[model samples]
Structure formats: structure tokens, C-alpha cells
Target: MVRCSHVHLYKNGKCNSWQIGKEDKKRMASNQGSSHLNGHSDIFLATSRDDQILFNGILFYLGQKYIEGAQHLPWWRTDGVILTVLLHAGPVEFLYYWLHRALHHHFLYTRYHSHHHSSIVTEPITSVIHPFGEHIAYFTLFAIPLLSTVLTRTASIVSFAGYITYIDFMNNMGHCNFEHIPKWIFSAFPPLKYIIYTPSYHSLHHTQFRTNYSLFMPFYDYVYGTMDKSSDSLYESSLVRKEESPDVVHLTHLTTPESIYHLRLGFAYLASEPHKSKWYLWLMWPVTLWSTMVTRIYGRTFTIERNIFKNLKLQTWAIPKYSIQYYMQWQRESINSVIEDAILDAEEKGVKEEGLNRNGEFFVRKHPQLKVKLVDGSSLAVAVVLNSIPKGTTQVVLRGNLSKVAYSLALALCKGGIQVFTMREDEYKKLKEKLSDEAGNNLILSKHNVPKTWLVGDGLSEDDQQKASKGTIFVPFSQFPPKKTRKDCLYNNTPAMLAPKHLENVDSCENWLPRRVMSAWRIAGVLHAMEGWNVHEVGNMMFDIEKIWKASLDHGFRPVTSFAESKAN
Candidate 1:
């Protein structure tokens, strides 16, 4: 039979492959061309793996019985044994090359070899795994070596057993995924390097799939011109790696900001509602959260004044008559369109991009270099994240005519002693009309047109210097910085566009801040979720206001409403 060693064939219950849960296994299979098929479905009708293995085993035993009873030859006559052994190797290798190549034919690849390629890394026991039809083809081809000796009546069972054992030994070694050939051996006999294959040599075939298709030796690959360019270098590297621990990556859903928040909420809800009291019934808060998330389909729409309803038009007065879900969906679509337009506009204006993919799409490599934890979180989630910045950070910078919601957010940062830097006096005055009198005065805006001085500290390194960096926080509604400028002393929360991707979960509770100051809290939550800070730190800011600001950005969680006897600490 053709010696196929690179990829493993099957993995069911004790599978070390990526699949863990039943649902996930089925989902994984969906990507591999069988989206509609069930995970455990047999390859063909009446072709269960158990039945195939049993049938193949019966054939092997019968072959052995026939050889013993019918060969009628000495177990080991030196001349006959030698002749049969020499006769077996030549034709077996020749036929195997063609048969193996045929297996890669489009129809055969999908039906037969695709099952083998499922495992990118092979284990030794995975050697015999194959489709029943594939095994049948193998059995027919493997009989050539035995049939040649028998037809000439030159067969000795002893010689046949020795040849078969050699093939199995070499095949298992190829699949072991460990380099057993020492580097000194290759250096000692350079000619033997042409004949022997390493685990790394076969592994390239599994991962890259275009070259290195040989069973016993790479001689055919050399003659047919199918060798991979990196095979020899890879083989050398695998030998060096033999003494080191192998790298392994486990496949599973990683923790996210959403899952973290959900777990925390669920944990506290259960603690407060321990089984001793009715509060214990609040253990269902996660289910409630999930349900609200499932049902939350809403958005905040802007108007000439203020509109609480889900308004479609930008400047129209809106009444509280539409579903929140409809509003949120509208905002999602509007955001995507605006972002697309902005990107195109930037490109037209000759704005340079940092990173480009194969498809020629430009990526913002330096948009923000957040801590790894906030890599995939929403921009808005940062509004609620907290840092250890002193409660005395009181500077403001306004860049342009920003939304009223944004001004209110700047006001909150000012309350926490933050310094914000923004636009010139004319721009600040225009923005002042959008905010209420109390918020407008508290903004603490800084005029950026005037130049400021700073110590150079040119001779001193960062550690040697006595001073540290500080400046205004930037959370503009929209911004486009000049080419190649790295704005470090700012937290530019202005999104590229208001796309669905820009939002957190597309649910109602996603932005369920109280109606009176919804914009401020939402912006705060987004700010809070970024940097190395998170929602828990934001919670610390409201330790005294137990009833109002207990949980997360929305402050949605509360103890039993009637449990007024004692407030939770």
C-alpha cells in the first residue's frame, strides 16, 4: 500500500483536535465542506468506522492463514528468501507512486484524502485511519508484492513478514512528528540524505499541501519536481527543536469584555440574593441580562433640541413612539455609511495609511495601542474604564464644534480633575451654544492656538528625569490627524465611523443609562473600558451612592426594591 504518513485521519471521542463541545464540533465541520451534514454521520451508508476496522482486520488474518497453509514452502530457505525479498521492493515502490498520485485527483481528494488532511499534526496510532474504499484500494495494491513471489513459487513467509515489518516501521516513524535522524548522521553520509525522510519533511506536506508527496523516500518527488523549497531547512530546524518543548495552541473562545462583565454581574447578583432571602431569586439576573440583550434593539437619535425617541431624521423633533431596537439598527447603518464615506474622503485628500493587507485595504496601525485586554472591546466601553489618575486632573481642550453629549463627557472628566485640550476660542464659543449654561462654564476648555513651553530634558533619560508627561484628553466627535503624527498625550475617543462594529452588543441594555443623563454615562462607560482600566474601577467612584450607581455603565443592578430595611454595603 502507499505509505501515507503526514496527516492524521480521524478523531472521535478522545479527540485532541480543536473540537471540545458537541455544538462546536458540528460548527467546525461546517467549514470543511459538510455544512448540512451531521458531525457523526458515516462516510457512506452501512460504513461505520467500527465495521470498516473489523472487516480490514478479518482480511489481514485470512491473508496470513492462506499464506501459511497454501505457500507450502520452507519458512526460510536462504536462496528463495533472498530472491523473494529482492523481487518485492521494486514493483511495490513503482506501483505505490502512481496510486498515491491518483489519490490527489479532485474527486478522490475530496472523497478520500480530505479525511486525512483534517489533522494538521499526525500521531503514530493515526497511521491506519482511512476510508473503507481507500483501504480496499490499498489492499489490492499491496497484494502485488506477495502475489509476485507466490506466482513465481519463490515466496517464503519469512521474507514477506520481514518486508511488511520494515514498511510499517518506516511509515510510523514518518508520522511521529519528531526528528529521529541525528544531524551528525546526515553530515557523515551526505548521499544517505537523499534517501531518508524526516518527520519535518512529511509535516510540510500536511500544512502546505502542494509538494513533498512520497511514501518511503523523496526520490519520486525529486524526479517528478514536486519538492517544497523549504523542506530541507525545515528538517534541520525540527532536529534542533528536538531537545526543546513543542509549542501547542489550544483552540477555544477567549475571554472578552462582554463575558467578563456578564460573569461579574452574575456573580454579584447571586451573592446579594443568597438562598436565605428573596434577594436570592436575583440569581436569574444573567438570564435577565441575556434576555434584555436579546431584546435590546434601540438607539439614541439627535435632534435640534433633545429627543428621547428613536428618531430617523437628524434634526427633526421626535416623540417617544418608536421601538429602541429600530433606533439602534438605524444608528448602526448610519454609522457604517458615514465611516465608509470618511475613509474614501481621506483617501481622496491624499491621507497616507500605515498598514496594507493583500487586498490593498489600508489599516490604522496606530489608531490606539491599548492594553491587550481592550484589543477587541468597544470604544464606548472605555468611557467607564478607570485609571489611578489623581482626582485633580482639571484641564480641558476642545478641538471643534462637538456634539452636546461629547461636551458633557468632557465635563465629567473635568470633575475628576482631567485636563482636556481642544480648539481655538471661536470654535469653543460656537460649541458653547450647544451646551447648557452650567455645563458650558464647567467645561474648563483650553485654547490650543497659543503655544505652551515645556522642559527639554534632552540630556536625561526617562528614568533619570524628575518630570512625567501630562496633557489634555481628546474625545472628539470626529477627527482626522495629519500624516505620521503620533498623538500620545491624548485619548482620542472619536470613532472612525458609527458602524455596528463600533458599538458593543447590539442590544437594548447596551446603552440603558438613565434617561436624564444618558449621554454622559454612555460616554463615560466607553472611556472607562479602555486603557488598562475597566468598569469595576468606575464602580469605586460611586461607593457612596449605593442605590444609583451599583453595577456597570448603566448602573442597572439594584437590591430588592422593597428591602429598604438595610441598604447593601
Candidate 2:
């Protein structure tokens, strides 16, 4: 009996992640052209891809169950394989070529084929989006090879499996919208072009809608005069295309060892949702250990995400070191080396702006001669925190490790006639020295008083959270979010905003931020490029808070309100 191994398919086969070609590279540089469908679509549109896979599975199951002499077929037979190939390259190819052309005819085109052609820019999944009736017709056409082998009692399980796998691979490759098939293959064997089709070949079929109608082979198209004239030129150009530099690059680091899987290159579903550690991941502890060891040994910067806004290309790169490494004194130099290399690389790429989180500030400060505008996004983050504060509040307790954002927020609050209280004498004196006489008067030292509003940052202690009254709001100005200790108290998300409607491919949430939301620090870099600000907003330097706030709104990044604050209001 033929033994079939249960196979679980990854997205577009195993090579999808590694085979990003020129066009695929371009698509990878932006989130706009991903294969994931939005949930807002109708039920049919949403589930159509899954349904197509199911349909194929049903066809295979029925063929095995009902066909005579199919169940106990041998695993391999040379004659069966040769016959299958000849039958497919002749009968199946010929039939499919004409059938595809007929689908484009006016009557069939509008009724069924148009659904498949709806996407001009195709992804791998786009190959399977035909209507149910079209699927039945196409499957029947493909069944020619399988049925012939079965009826003749010459069928082998390997022959059937190989044919189906070939079909699936070819279908996906043709619609991938990227040129991955190496030109060398065709050059070595000129006859292969007639037998094997490329992505550019099928792309012409979609764009022109009248030519290149051969299925997997161009022999019939050449004979019947339906071949596209520009096919070879397009393929050659796509092969020689060079990589383009992005306008902006945001540098970040892996938060946890498991956080590696949360990157877009890792798992699509996990990357899209808010990041959280799964309990089952421990089962792969050996793999995780190897990854962590490899990353530590070969620490280099790598691309994490790619995005586009307006006409500008933006990319997010992560330092190989995990978050814990950043805190180790021994790891500081290694971390600095990775960050400096990234900054220098960005500068070389003609990137106008590079954003670094708080961890990267040391490098920017140490290297004053850098030409690229390095921004920490402190101005916009401060703006987000200021706007999150509830109105009609006179006093706010400032607690946590004082970072640049926290310092700026305290000054802004004090200047706006709101009293700022600090529990630590050293923090109060440090803040007092920087504040103007008018703002300084508003800064107070107190320990026992409780205010409903608190502007918190990193290093916030559990004791501090425990002291807060019920319904107290904790608004963070730090790059990292503080741990939640009080359920009754409302803890706002780290400063972030809803992304503009035009932001495409926002299928994944940013860390803990909801879908279509971006952190203020990240957005600040985009704003700098959009406004063409020449000055670097690094170290203690900050832009006008009001200006930044207005610009964020003008660019369509809406302020995110905490649920607790919203409920209280």
C-alpha cells in the first residue's frame, strides 16, 4: 500500500521566507503589499483562500477513495512517472492553455475569470482564488494525468504526489509577482524557456489580459500567436534590478529571547498580534537556546520590519542583542558597536533620518560628528504624555527613574500651572535646578499626598503603585512600559497614537499597542522626514511640544486615550 505522510504547509512552501527576489525585496521594504487579508472584508472574500485549499484536498481524497486500483498503488514506478509527464506536458498543458483563453472570453470572463484577475499585483495565495465552478473545471482538466495512470493500472503514489506538488509550486511561483527563477537556468538550456514559465510571463497575462495564455509552457502560445511581446525584456529587467535605499530607519532591540519569533520573518500570525510569551514555546527550548547562542556570538543588525508612508520607504532594524544584554555593564561596548554600525550603515544608505530608542542615546551622544539626523523622539513622546493627562487637574505626582522624557514632561506640566510633586529629595533638587523661577515654584517635594493624576516612567516601584488610590491614572513617558501592579488603577499604554488611515499593511500591532497604532518614538522619525527638519533632536534637545502635537494630528496620528481614563470621563 502507498504510504502518505501528513504534511503541514507553511506560507507559500518553505522557501517563501528566504527567496525574496528583487520585486519581493521591494515588497518586503513596505508593509503595503503583504498577502494577509483584512478582517473588514465580506465572509466570502475573507475565507476564499482557505476554501481553495480545502477544495484541492477534497479532490485528492475523492480520487483516492473512489478510483479503482488507486488505494493499493505502489510507491514508485518509472514508466508511470514518464507517462504522467508526457500526458501533462501534452494533453494537460494544451487543454489548460485553451481553457484559460476561453475564460477570458466576454461571457466567461465576467461570470468567473474576473474574480481571479481582481488583484493586479499578485501574491502566492492569489493563484487559488478562482470561483467554485472554475475550480471544478480546472481540477477536472488537471485530473487527466492521474485518471489515465489509474485506469491503465500503471499508477504509482509518487507519480501522483510529484505531479500535484509540481503544479502547486508552479502556480505559486507564477503569481508570486517576483522574479526569483534564475536567468542562468534559461541561458544554460534555451529549450527550458518553452517548457517552464516565469513570474514575468504570467504577470503579462494579468496586465494585458489578451496574451501569454499558455499554462506552464509557452509552446502553444507561440504556435497560436497569443504570446506577449515584452515577456523576455521584462524578465531580464526584473533580474538586473538593484536595491533602493530607504529614507528612514528605526533601530530597536529584541526585548526577550523568545521575542525573535515575533519578528515578521519568524511567524506571520504571532508577529501581527501584540507580543506575548506562549507557554508551549518552552517545548522548543533547545532551538531557542541555539538561536540565543548564535545571536550572541554573531551579533549584527538585521531588518525587523519594513513600512512605507507617503512616497518614502521606512525600515525597522533590530540589534542582535536581547533586552537583558543592554543592561549588563559588560555588554555595553558590544551593544554600542552594533548600534554604531547600524547608524553608520544608515548614513551610508543616504537615510535622511535614523531613530534610536533610549538605549541608543549613548552612541549618539558619544559621536557628535555624525551627519545623519539622529532623533530620540523625546519631543513627540512628551507631547503624547501631556495630552493624555486629564483636564481640570491641578496636581500630578512625578515618580520613576527620571529619563529625558520625564524631565521634559515635568517642566511642561509645571509651566502650564500644574503643581508637580516629587517624593525623592535628590530628584526634586535636580529638576529644580533646570526649571525657570516661575516653573520652579510649581515643583514641590511631598511623600504623603496622593493625586489622581501621575506621570510615571521607568524604574517605577511596586511600592509606588501600591500607594496609588483607586482609579488613579498612571501615564508613562518612558520608552518601555512599566509593570502593572494595581488592577483598580488605570495604567495607560506607553505613548502611542493611532496610525493614519492611509498607512497600509498594518496587519500587526506594535508590541502592546493595538492594531493600526504606532509608538510616538517611532512616529517621531517619520515626522522628522516629512517636515524635512535638518536639526538633530538628540540628547537633551527637544522641539516645540505644541508644534509636535499639532504636526502629529495634522499628519492623521490620533491620540490614544487609556480605557480607564475614557471610562472615568
Candidate 3:
């Protein structure tokens, strides 16, 4: 229910709700209260939806069997439309207002209404998650208008269908947790306030528990003096467009073509997990192909998702280019333009710091004088790779395309008394030059020695895996994950930490990272803002690994093995 693909629920990052896959029961128990007791289960939501369909069917059957004018086929009737609206605005709203207030009384509230109130931050589906007894009472109350219209011979199919559609629209809109009802309408027509209630108004009913009891219309709440005192101000505050400012921006890009669907604006379910090639997604290849083409021509960076980490606002921005495009030699200038534009745009928006993926290093070299602090997060990533090496391991193979993190990881490992071996003489020389004389003593260049732990990076090949011993663990030091070459060997996820449970609106996974897990590159920008550090960690310079590691732990970020643990589970 939390991450259902509802249009009203997700637009503009307005809804403040989280859960997508399996419930983090231990983490959820601290906050969700009794709502954690099976109400949020997929089965409960499915059954609740089915029950409403069944209830509507029974109502139709009764009407066709007993009502005089229920089976009529006229499509439109002006008189019927007028009568239905009048009936709802008068009797339907009045009676339901009382019924709703009555349901809040202690006896009924405990048995039925509390279930609906459990979701303090609501979704569109939250409007229907109620006990069966409550559904029955609601169906009967709603049937008043239909029954009255049918008996009076003023009912038509349009009037009946239109009234039902209105109810569904109003119910979903009010619970969507986003204020879609523009305040300008109320300003233009002052009397419309009595007839319409905004999402903020209904939200108060759930939060305050006793006031603002009207359903879709606020007339009764005003008449009875039960409306919340802050409804108008709250509505105004939610609508005011504040400046576009964020504490940190994680600048990344799309990966495989299938990654198009993994964006938050894309499919909800796919976005909530690691990227995987799905057979069903192949059927959607045309759309994927079209999207890729569009991005190539568009050449801009756009926000894919947003989150609130503690009190800070976080955003993930994606350059229109894909990972494959970044590899193409001809696309370098175009790619640079897209990335530069994104950083400048972030700077213009008052972004304090911007985190870059590995490919973004080009911008640091090209535009060294830029104001916003740019971080590559190599320090934390190096720390993660070093700590991931199994305990009591004396030696490990370091392979693949040598990056700043890879070099730093090798040096740190050699410095710690663990022997670092490299098969490539060129990579060995590159790393040896950067190490201290004592640390360099542990670095060995050889092709014959086999180590069970291989610290790999980008461009790891199938041949590399074949040379390694069977069941070897491939731990990645690169921003992107290495392709799995041997099913017999274990692969770990890249450097990331399990995000705190309190981070709000984290409904999607970060690339291949698990639910609620954040990549170190992304987290580095956040740490920069939290620490109020003003330095740009670009090119060869990086923050102290120990300091970043300690800061991450202090902020409740627990280290996770790249992919080994997730694959095992």
C-alpha cells in the first residue's frame, strides 16, 4: 500500500510514506504502532480492494431486482445529474458527516475507525483499508443517493456512474497527502470552501483525531464548528512554492536500458529493488528504446528521486546519458555538457554539495573553479573495501581497471600487513609509486600466486574469474558493480551502508543496493553537508578514510557487504 503506483500519491515527492518490499518489522515496530499488525500486508490490501468490488456488485444486484428505474439505459439526463448532486450536497453529505463522527466515538473507534487512522502518512489506497463491518456501513450510507434517485425515476446510467466516480475521486484525492486543490479556486470563489475540502484539510482529521470530520465538503464541519483551526494556514503553506534548495545532490546517470524503468518516475515495484533483466521487460523494449533516444537528444540532468535524511533534503539527479554512452568516444563533449549543466543547475538551486559517480571526475578536471563542493566518496569506498576482506586473510588479489579508490584500497591493505598482489605489471607499478616504502614492501607483482579474496574493480573480465580459484569472493572497489563471470564464485555489492530507518520517502533502492541501503558516493555528499565541510574532494584528493568511516557510523550508517550477503540470502 505504501508504494502502490498511484498518480496522486507520488507526483512531486509530496506524499511522505516509505515501504515497498518486505516489511522491516523490527525497524517499523518502533514507529508504525498497531498499523504494523498485518494491515499493511499485500494480502490485506488486495482483499480490501476485492471486497469493495463485491460490495458494489451486491448493491447493483439489489437495485436491478427491486428498484423500478434501476435497469434504464439512458446515457445522460440533465435532471438526473442535477438531482444527484443536490441529494449528495444536502442529505448524503449531512448524514455521512454524522456517521463519520459517530464512528469516532470510543466503542466504534477502537473496533473499526482506528484501523483506518493507523496510517498517519496516507496513500490513495489508505482510504479503503478498513474493517469489513465499516465497509458495510459505508456502502449503505453511500447507497442513499442511488436509492433515492432510482425511486424518484430520475436516475440514468451517467448519473449513477458519475456519482460513484465522484466519490472515488474525492476519497482518493483527500487521502493522497498532496494538496492538489489549488488555493486560487477558493480565492476566486469564496463560497467554494463550503463545498470542497483539500487534502491538507482531510489530513488534519487523521492527525488531530477529533476535528475536521467532513468527508469531501467542509460545510458541515463549519456549521458544527468541528473544523481544525489551522486548516487554511496549513493549506496555504503547503501550496507556497519555496525556493528550489537542497542540502545535498547525488549526481548519477542511467545504467542499462532497463534502468529506465528503475527510476522513481517509472515503475514502483522495479524501482524498489536492484536492477535485474526481466523477461517481461523485453516486451517493453520499444518504450525503452524510445526513452533512450529521447535522453540522448535531450541531453540534460533531471531529478529522479527525493528523500529527507534527518532534517536535510536529498535528491538523486540523473544525466540523460546512459552508462554505455559514457563509454563512446564521440559522446565525450556532449556528456561533459550534460554533467556541467547539472552541476551549474545544482549550484543555481543553492545546493550545498554535489556527490558524483565515478564518471563525473571529468567535470572536476574541466571546471576546477566551480563553487559547490564536489565529492567522489573514494575515501569511504576505500574503507569499505578494506573492511570487507575476510578476517585472518594474509593475502588478496587486486585486479581490474585501477581507479583512485582501487589505488587507495591497495595502499591501505598493504599498509595494514595484508599482502596486496597484482597480476598486471603496469597496474602494480602505478600502485607501487603511490605507496610508502614500508607499504610498498607488501605489494607483489606476480601471475602465479592465487588468493581466495580478489578485490576487483571496473572492466573485470570472464577470463579474470576463470583464473581465480573456484569459490573466490569478488569484492568491488568501483562505483559500478562488476559483471558476474562465475556462478561458483561469490560477488559482493559495491561500497554502501544500510540507511537509518527514519529516512523518509525512501521507496526506491539505490541502483543495485538493497532496500534502505545507500551507496557511499551518495552518502558522502550528505556527510559533507552534515559536517558543514567546504572542501571539494575531487581528482586525487580525498577525505581521511578513518574520519569518514567514523562519521558514517556516528550517523547510523551500518556497513553491508557488496552482494555476498544479499546473494546468500
- Candidate achieving the largest TM-score: 2
Global local distance difference test of model 1: 0.39
Query: Which is the better candidate, 2 or 3, if ranked by TM-score?
Result: 2
List runs of model 3 lying over 4 Å from the truth: 1-126, 129-134, 140-166, 182-197, 201-237, 241-244, 285-313, 348-350, 357-371, 414-419, 425-445, 500-507, 561-569
Task: Please give, for residues 1-569, the per-residue lDDT of candidate 2 as tens digits.
Answer: 00000000000101122132466444332422332234533455546677777988987898799978889989998989999999999999999998998887767876777667766677888888877887788889888989999988889989998998999999999999888899999999999999999998898776677889998999899889999998998888778755556677777777777877777776778878877778987887887899789888887877666676776676677777777776799998887777777777766665665555554456567776766777778888899988888878899999988878888988999999999999889999999988999999999998886687889887889998888889999998876778988999888888989888877656666777777778888888888788877667766678888888899899988887854346589
lDDT of 1 by residue, 113-148 (tens): 656655556666445556777777766766676666
Of candidate 2, the 10-residue stretch with the lowest lDDT total is 1-10
Q: Residue 328's C-alpha lDDT in candidate 3?
A: 89
- CA lDDT, every prediction? 0.39, 0.77, 0.77
Residues 330-432 of candidate 3: C-alpha lDDT, one tens digit per residue: 9878876776777777666656555554444566677677667778778887877777888899999999898788888887888889899899899989998
User: Rank order by TM-score, top first?
Assistant: 2, 3, 1
All candidates: CA RMSD in angstroms? 24.1, 9.2, 8.3
| C-alpha positional error of residue 136 in candidate 3 after TM-score superposition, expressed in Å | 2.5
Residue 567 in model 3: lDDT:
69
Q: What lDDT is reached at residue 528 by model 1? A: 30
**Candidate 1: minimum summed lDDT over ten consecutive residues — where?**
1-10
